[model samples]
Each structure stands twice: as C-alpha cells, then as structure tokens.
Target chain A: MSVSIDARGPRWSAAITAVVLATALVTSNLWVIAFQAVVFAIGAIRGPQFTPYALIFKKLIKPRLKSEPILEDVRPPQFSQAVGLVFALVAVIASITGAGGVFTIAVGFALAAAFLNAAFNFCLGCQMYLLILRVRTAK
Target chain B: MPDVHYAHIDAESHLELVRKLDIRSTPTTLFLNSAGVEVGRAMGTPKRAQVQAAIAAIH
Candidate 1:
C-alpha cells in the first residue's frame, strides 16, 4: 500500500507543464509564456502553495492520507532548479549576444532533464545533495 | 522509544514553530519522552541507528 503512490497523473501533468513552459521560455514564444503565466498566477493566488497541476489534481482526486517518513519534505538544494535558473539566465545573455539557437538548446536540455526526472523520479538535484553529504562526511 | 509523528508545516508556519521550539534546520527530529518532555534532537538525516540509540537512551 505504501509503495502505491497515486502520483502518476500529477507527476505527468507537472512534467508536461514544465516542458511546455520551458520550451516557450527557451523559444521566446510570448503567447505560450503568457498562457502559462496566467495558469500559474491563478493557481498561486488560489492557495499560495497551489501549483497549477496540483490544483487540478486536488480538485479531481483526493489524496489518501497515510503516515510515511517525511523524507520528501526535506528541502535540500534542488539541482534541477539551479540548472533551470542558470539556463534561463544564460538564455537571456545569449539572446543579447545573438546566440539564440545555442541558448534555446541549453534550455531545452534542462527542461528535458526535468521531464526525464518526472518519469524516473531520480532527480539530478537530489544526487547533488547526496554528493555534498558524502563530501562533507568524508572530510 | 518516542513515536516520531512527522508534521508538514509550511515555510512561514515552520519559521514560527522553529522560533518557538528553537529548532534551526530541516530533518530535525524531536525526541519526546512519555511525559512529552523533549529529551534530545538531531538534524539532517541522522542514521536510523543513531536515532534508535538516542531513543534507547531516553527509554
């Protein structure tokens, strides 16, 4: 029962939204960005912690409360988030430098990695946390 | 052994609670005795054995 996480739908939806938003940002598609921004704003305004897909999922499905280790609550540094931030910043700089294609590709890769993580739930950022722990403990 | 009942407090609420409890970081396990007095605490993913040892000491 514990292993049967009904997170499939939420995870996939989140992945799709992430991919679409990242692609739009990378490609500089104002329409797509605007659409996603509207959705994100609506969700955030609803509950402050309301993610777009989480809002939808919570509306349609109820989560079965069960006691589990709070490990998921551990907010260690997220590598994907860092990578996304860096890519977004670099993309802006690259646009100024007229290297749009390379910037778009870098953003695409970051978004793809995120989507891959959704499918696998094996976060590169979580791995970074493990690596940092290992290094700190080694010394 | 203290039954570790985890609570998912939001960042803002967590700040308030931590301020009151004097906890500073995540993975902060509060060990309470049967009388609900705090006996020990650990931060950041202390090994299960370490937690058990702490719990055993309290017991």
Candidate 2:
C-alpha cells in the first residue's frame, strides 16, 4: 500500500537536519555527526514518521499550525532519508578514520541538501529518486 | 563588471540545460573564466568567503 504523509513533516525534519549539520561543521565535532548519522539511520530504517524530528513536528509543531498540510507520497522522502543516511554514514566513517577532508565534503553535501529542502522545498534526493524511477521505467 | 559575465539557467524550465550540464542539484555555482573554462565549482549554499576564494583562485 502506498503511504502518504504531511509534506511539511519532511521539510520540518530537513530544517532540524540543517541546523544539526551546520553545528557539526562549525564545531568539527565527531560526536555530533555521529549522532546525526544515528538519527538518519533510524529515519531510513523505520521511515520518516518515526524520526526524532518527525516526532517533534508531530508533537510540538503540527498542533500549532493553523492550516492543514498538503500530503505527499512517503516513498520519495523515505528514499531521501536513505540517501541522507548514506551521506551521514560516510561522514561518520570518515571522522572515525580521521579523514577530515572526506568528512567535511560528505557533511557539506548533506548540509546543502538539507538546506535546500528546508528553505526552498527542493529535495535533491527526492529528485534523484524520481530520476532513477524514470530511468528504470524507461528501460 | 570585473570582466565577468553571469548567466542563470532555470533548471526546472531548462531541462535540456540541466541534462547538458549534468546538474544533479539546485544552487550549483560554476566558476568559469574568460575562455569558458570551468575553474571551480560550489554546490549548494556557499558562503560569501568561499565564493570570493573561488574567484580569487581563478584570477
């Protein structure tokens, strides 16, 4: 069965992700990136609805919003979360291996994707998912 | 200004351009010199200093 979700939930999650990534970049904290990786893993494995940020949005933010959110299929965002998980994992591994440049680049890419989603509602990973789907169906 | 010409391509409307450039993401900035040679690239939201440094490197 296809599952739909409040489109705003992913954006809200992305906003929190951007902040967390920016903090990780600024502080150069291995633990912070590691923590975000765990968050991404959870989101990827269990779905975006079960993510910590999504829980915060459901519990704290959604009730405060005045209007109903536009719902979207959860597949794209779930795929996006998986993409984020990959980047976060790469960053975490890079950090653990003391590969600073790789870690920075991975975190930078993740931060950029998150900022785009939060600010412009442009989900790069979602777009990528669509593109892949298109290619697969075309074949 | 400063011997630089800027062109903006709307990725949504210009799918051909996006495909031609192989642009996988939004807010991708490419630094090209006078000869149309790509010198540097910054993806996503780049800091002002990063842009400045990219420009400086090309010059």
Candidate 3:
C-alpha cells in the first residue's frame, strides 16, 4: 500500500479564482452575489468535494476531498469538509438574515487566496492544516 | 521530440498504452513533428528549452 498526503491549495484556489473572475465580469448586483452564495451553500450542504473536484478527487494520488473510505495508505483530506459544511450553514443563515455582504466579502477573500495560490503555488489550506496540527499536538 | 497531451490515464490502462509505444521509462517524452514523425525523445522531465527547440525544429 502506498501512502499519499493530500495537501495542496493550488487547484482549489484556481477553481475559486475562476469562479470569482467570471462572477465579477458578469455581475454587479447584490442579488447575483446572493445567488452565487446560495449555490455555494448548496455545495457545502452536500459535502466538500461535492461542489469542486467532484470528478477527479477520487482519482488523484492523494485526494483533497474524501468521498470514499480512507484507505489504509492514503492520507485524509487536509481540511474537514464537514467544517466547510458548517460554514455553509452559517453563510446561508447570514444571507437570510441580511448579512450577505459579510459572506460575499469573505468569498472575495477566498477568490484572492486562489489567485495567490495559482501565481505562487502557495497553499493557504496547508498553512491552516499546520496551524491546526500544532494546536492539536501542543502539550 | 514528441508532443504528448497528457490526459488522465488510469493505472489499469497505463501499461497497455506504454507497451504500444517505444517508451522505456516511467516518465518518457516523445517529440514529433507536424507530420507525426518522431525527432527526439527523452526519459523524465526534459528541459523546457530543449523541448521548445525540438518543436521549433519540426516547425
């Protein structure tokens, strides 16, 4: 069995950047942003890889999203998609409560982070993993 | 040099595809001209400049 680590932010960042660029070019209305938020929330509600990488995550050496039982060898996804699901729930509630501006701004930041990964191969998710692991292992 | 579009090839079919070619390495690059004639080949990641030169020559 081969063990593979699933930690990279470039691909996800690339996807987010593409989403933002397309959205920014085609939309200026608050309702458009809210619609996009709802779409993303649906994805989160489904699961992590449910929205992005739904096709290839299963094929990669190390998946960034988990859709199957973790192999004895393959590393788990870097982030808990369940956590993202929770955020999606919060985002949906926030939008319904007329706080969509905050969630949209956060989505904007995620888009920026994706572009950063594309240009620099930086993985913000990996950094987040490091921080979480440190906190977990700290005595 | 052969220009290959690396598509998502599955492991089950990887060996079959490899056998059809003259490739002899885990990572092999084949260079070909517009006529589909091979001019150069290499094992593993070749220098970008070298690949460019081969394609330029073919062109």
Candidate 4:
C-alpha cells in the first residue's frame, strides 16, 4: 500500500534538524551532534512519523495549521532521510577521528539540504535518490 | 508562461523519468515547449533570476 503523508512532517523534520545542527555547530558539542545524527538516521530508516520532530509537530504544530494538508509517496522523503543519515554519520566519524574539516563539511552539507526543505520544500537528496535508482536500473 | 508547468519526480516510482531525463544531479530544471520538446535545461542550483529568464523564454 502507498504511504499517506501530511507533507508537513518532512518540513518540520528538516526544521528541527537545521536547528539542532546549528546548535551543535555553534556549541561545538560532538555529543549533541551525535545524538542529533542518530535521531536523523532512525527517522530515515524507519519513517518521519517516528522522528521526534514529527512527533512534536503532530502534538504542538499540526493542530495550529489551518491550511489543507496533502499526502505524497514516502519513498522519496525516506530516501532523503537516508541521505541525511549518511551525512550525519560522516560528521560523527569525522568528529571521532579528529578530522575537523570533514566534520564541518558533512554537517554543512546536511544543513544545506535540510534548510532547503524547510525553506523551499526542495529535496536535494530526493534528486540524488532518483539518480541512484536510474543507475541501478540502467543495466 | 501560460502553458508552462513543472513536476517534482522522485526516485521511487519515477525512476524511468529520472533515467530518461539523464538526471545525474540535484536541482535540475528542464524547460520544455508546448510540444513537450526540451529546449533548455539547468543542472545545478540556479538563482531566481536564471529561472525567471528560462521561464520567460519558454515557448
């Protein structure tokens, strides 16, 4: 069966990620960043509804919105979460390995994608997901 | 621009479109004419002015 999405879930997830990541970046707290990354990975692997941000939105934010909600396929955004997980993992590894540049770059990349989603409703990871599928199916 | 329209294709069900369009990058935009002919394309994150110009030239 196809997944029913409220669309707002992913946007809120992105917003939460952006805020948490920004905090991590500013505070230089590897532990907090690691927690954030793990949360992102879990969300991607399972579903946005399982994410903390989604839960918060469902409880506090969704009730306030008056516009009609819409649903879309889950695969694309799910794939985006996977992409996010990868970046977050990369940052985690970089921090553990003492590679500051790599950590910054990884977190920065993830932040940019999340920011795009929260601000413009665009998914760069979804675009990459399409390319990967194309390559896998090409032969 | 009246006839201009766009779509957001994902990797799950629309893999065929992704392949057919040769989409190797994110934030790609394709400009097609009324006949569904591809006349222009962009492969990276483009600015608003660039998109505006592309849509303005759409036929």
Most lDDT-accurate candidate: 2
Q: Across residues A1-139, which tens digit of lDDT does each residue of candidate 1 receive?
A: 0111233333444475567757675567645544544544443344212555655555664454342322333232233344445655565566567786866775576566657667765445544543454444443
Better of 2 and 3 by TM-score: 2
> What is the C-alpha lDDT profile of model 2 across A1-139, one tens digit per residue?
3666888899999999999999998887989998898888888888888999999999999999987677666767888999998998899899889999999999999999999999998888877864565444443
Q: Estimate each model's TM-score.
A: 0.44, 0.69, 0.40, 0.72
Per residue, candidate 4 scores C-alpha lDDT tens digits across A1-139 of: 4576787788888988898888777766789789887787877888767888888989999999997786656666788888888888888888898889888888888889999999988778766676677778877
| Alpha carbon lDDT of each predicted model | 0.52, 0.82, 0.46, 0.78
Q: Considering DockQ, which of the candidate structures 1 and 3 is the better prediction for this target? A: 1
The local distance difference test score of model 1 is 0.52
CAPRI-style grade of the A/B interface in model 3: incorrect
B57 in model 2: Cα distance from truth in Å?
52
Reference-based lDDT, residue B14, model 2: 55
| Steric collisions counted per model | 1, 0, 6, 0
The C-alpha stretches of model 4 lying farther than 4 A from their native spots are B1-59
Top candidate, metric TM-score: 4
TM-score head-to-head 1 vs 2, winner: 2
User: What are the per-residue Cα lDDT tens digits for candidate 3 across A1-139?
Assistant: 2333322332552455447534742453445445545444444454334444533444552354543432211111224333333444454465557675655554455555555555664435434443454444444
Q: Report the Cα RMSD per candidate.
A: 9.4, 12.3, 14.1, 5.6
What is the TM-score ranking, best to worst? 4, 2, 1, 3
Total clashes for model 4: 0
Model 1 regions lying over 4 Å from their true place? A1-14, A25-50, A61-71, A76-79, A136-138, B1-59
